[model samples]
Target: MCGIAGILRVHPLGSEVPPPDVAIPESWLDVLDESIKHRGPDGQGRFRDRATRPDGSVVDVAFVHRRLAIIDLACGQQPMVSERGPYPEKPRNGRVAVVFNGCIYNHRELRKELQSAGHKFVTDHSDTEVLIHGWREWGLEIHRHLDGMYAFSIWDHASAGIYSAVDLVGEKPLYTFSDWPRHTLCAFASTIPALARFQRAFGITPRADTHPMGFSDLLAYGFLSDDGSLGYTPIELVRRVSPRSPIGIFATRGSVRPEPCNPDPARLPAFSVRNSESPEAINAGNVEDILNRAVESRLRSDVPTGCFLSGGIDSSLMSILAKKLIGELQTFCVRMPRLEYDESPIAGLVAKHIGSVHQTLDCHGDPSGDVIQLIRQLGLPFGDSSLLPTHWVSRAARDAIGVAISGDGGDELFGGYERYRAAQLLQRFASFLRMVPSMTRYRRREKSRMTRIGRLVQAAKEGGYPALLMIFPPSELRQLASFPGRKPWEDDPRGDSVSQAMRFDILNYLPGDLLTKVDTASMAVALEVRAPFLATEIVRRSMMTPVSALMPHGERKGLLKAVARKYLPDEIVDRPKMGFSIPIGEWFRTDYGGMKQLLLDTLNSADPFPEDILGIRINRTFIARMVEDHMDRRRDHSQRLYMLLVLAIWSDWLRGLSGTIRN
Candidate 1:
């Protein structure tokens, strides 16, 4: 894993100076490098080149890389360059240079293939070298052959152009900035803060619009839109490199324009069943075979590796498979001080059953500190409560291992969430509810029972299962905001209601929330997390299976449980699903005094809460009432209140940073 940044200059026609004449100072690159040193602590490298195209247009590119040294610890230094020209032994200017973040599980296979094709590798063994050579061999098509989490940028010296791509699932992040008017710089980095600092230091004018639609989406859906075609970010000038998309920038007419490569539909995992078997005919062995291969592939790391065993079916299954494939696995689990929140005992049972070494870390302290640290590391507002425990587990695991395998995608893939069942139940009973007479009165008793049921019935009719999973309902959001109601983006139409919900999550929630949470939390501690469940093979198979097969007889993740029963005891396989969660609701009532004080202070402060920040005038009275209701036990508003708090904190942080930079 690593952090990469680069600057490219494009000089338009009739310009007084060519791009090569404009020098980007080494100190500026140093500043960019230092801004993200936390992402990679092992070492650093910098590369600079100025190339003149056939048309006499000049392009200057500088690349900086911070290394984490997961593989080829001694020789994996990068901004790695590929060997070039006929005399392989003699040193020459590299044809392609690359700085990559994230592991390539299939690098060994690719390496052997490249070697057989007459490509020579100079490193002892480094995936970075394989990627550079692969680029030389396959060009941008190299991204399709790679099977791992990655975000990379390659500078092709011969073409005077740059190529960049993020992984299929967006497990890693990349952000880009362009200052067209000044003609001074165009750059990309791993974080928004790095770009912000770069723009400030270089005096690049900030873009006029900050993309208010993004903030509107955040308020409506707890995350930015997954539609990467739209430029969405807190800063209008910066844009994210969309998942599974490649971007190219070439010096054309003495200027550069970023061209997004057309997405190859083949890159998407295509669902299929083996030998055209019916869903019922598919058995545990089929699922087990795919999962085992996925787990084995992620176990490819030079450093010591481990698994996060939450005692939930997903993580437990992953741990069991890792142990079976690689003996004596090291497993880590977080033990919350509260009994209701802790799963260490169950995890211990699984560890003992597998005969693996296990350790448990305690997460019992003031959460305010961790919340602040997480927000700072995230560089955005993410309201997932599990981030607290995920952060702790990553920190503990990093002390013992540089890489850890996780079971993040299992829930979305296998229908493991309670909401899936709830949606199904709503759909199943909607007809019965419709037959009952509507409640005509507005009394408290009527509102408590029939009114809520009516709303559910209406939601079912409208096929709003995705909205049912939201923290704040559209009605509530509209009351809090100035704008009219806006629905969240929908996924491509699927046949069944359950499959629609699953596809919705696979596109939005999985990438936007779950994957984002894991990446930010794990990388915050410099630990690489590989999700075996997210392997393309496993995901395609899971998605192909009918929802009824995945959750037979109202059992969530029924297919997964059936497979786990082969390797695990019945108790572990049959236990209720317990998510990795914090006791934030209870804490609001009893503990978390400091957090409460902070929220109250922010709400009561003299500084106006900018309506543009949330794209609505927030009802302060309603927010204050939510706090009181949670404290008084009149209502459990923890989730909604927490989301609001995160938005407020992130907004304040961004404002303060902007003020500091301007001063």
Candidate 2:
């Protein structure tokens, strides 16, 4: 794992005086350059390419890289470039230059293929060189040919246009900024922090345009949400690019457009379908092979690596495979002080079984409802309470290692979520109940379902994911605030519940909640954390299993559990599924005082939220009420309260961002 920043000028314009030797700020570059130092501790390298003007004038393109040195510790320092004349007909012809951040698990295999095809290398340096050579041989088609998590930029002096691509699932983050006609361009460390650093150095301000897609996605998906390509970065005094589908950037002056390299939308892989096969009879060899390869690929990092053991099937299975891939792996776990919320003991058992160096941290003290502070650092409004613990664990690991492999995206792909079965059962129940007379169904005294159905009666009303993860009922949202019409569903197709639900999540929450939380939390401490379970290959493979295979016999991620048991002992595998959750549900009820005070105090202060328009007062009273209800067994409202608190913090951050963007 590493950090890369660069500039691409399309058509060099001439100037009266020769272009200044230092066009882009060295200070700005350094700030952005060192932002992700935790990702690359071994070394840093910078490359500058200058385009000559008609009158001997020149503007520079600088690519900066901070090395982690996981693969070729000795000579793998990057801004790795290919040697010329190695493959004469190739695009690079040994002329490609690249700064990459990721592990190409299949690089060894790729190397053998390239060598057989008469390609040569200067050194057994790193995957950086392999990427440059791969692009030279295949052009933009290289993305589909690779199998690993990565975000890379290859500057082919020959191609002139710098080509950059994020991994298919976007596990690795790559952000770009370009405004000048033939000048400023950048791709750097995890979040907008890198750009913020550049802003200070270059005396540039950031801008923000509220992308409608952001809100559309937020309401639909339980988690992933991006405001646009601009995100919460607040890039002012510059033209910001909108979020385009994942693609290649052949960036030069004349062609600033992003070209889509991903397959047609119609051809994208399916996520779930029903399968009649019994979990026990599913092929075990394929399961083991896919998982083992996933583990082996993530082990390609240059820095000392470790795993986050959550004591669940996913993490336990990951630990088992990791031990085989990297001998004596270091594993970390978090223990909540609350007994009901703790998984540390179970995690410890898994670590011991794998013979890992296990370390546990007790995080009982309040990070003090520090959600607002986290929002500022993260540059977005993310509502996952678990992000705090995830951040804490990654920070602890980064103290000893630069990169860590995690067991995320496993539940999303596999049928490990208990909710998956619930969803399936709900679908069936909804179908069965539809057969009853509408009058009979309506006459029943079950107020909750009847009330919920009443709200969904509006053709304009769209509810799916929100129904699953909603804190307040639609009726409650209606009671809280009076909007002019039904909720906006710009991303939804005319209130189609199923389509809207899936669309909202895949487009928004996948990137917003899950990916965002993991990316920012890990990167905040400069740790490069990779999720092998999210590999595109795994996604494609898992999608092949029928939905019946998804949640086998009413178990969440049922198919996945069977796969886990095949590779792991029943003791290590059959444990109940525990999400990498914080003790917030318990904390809200038992230790409600501090959180209540924080919320009430923040709300009372100078918050610019449209509380009158969106009447959700995220104060201490609300938290107390939630705790009160949970204790009295009135309702299960902790998650909702947590979401509200996150939103309160989020609303505060958005106001601050408004100031920055305007200024």
TM-score of each: 0.89, 0.78
Clashing pairs for predicted structure model 1, backbone only: none
Candidate 2 C-alpha lDDT tens digits along 1-663: 666777654443343423433565566567777666655667898876654433333334667887766677777778886657465755466456788887787888788787786777777656766786687667766776677767787766555556667665566666666554433344444545565456556555443333333332332233544444434332332222222344444544433443444433322343332233634222344667777888888777656888889888878778888888778889998887667668899899878777989999767434554566566665544667778888888878878877787888776666555444334334435445334433312412212565334323321233423444444444344333322223533433332233234433444555557777887677566687878787666766565555445555656666667766655677767776656776565555455427656644544555534343123332445445555665565665555556656655655554444444211
Candidate 1 residue spans exceeding 4 A from truth: 18-22, 83-94, 180-184, 204-212, 229-231, 269-283, 425-463, 488-494, 552-554, 611-616, 660-663
Q: Report how far off residue 505 is in candidate 1 (Å).
A: 1.3
The alpha-carbon lDDT assigned to residue 423 of candidate 2 equals 42
RMSD of each: 4.2, 6.2
TM-score of 1: 0.89
Clashes counted in candidate 1 amount to 0
Residue-pair clashes per candidate? 0, 32
Total clashing pairs in model 2: 32
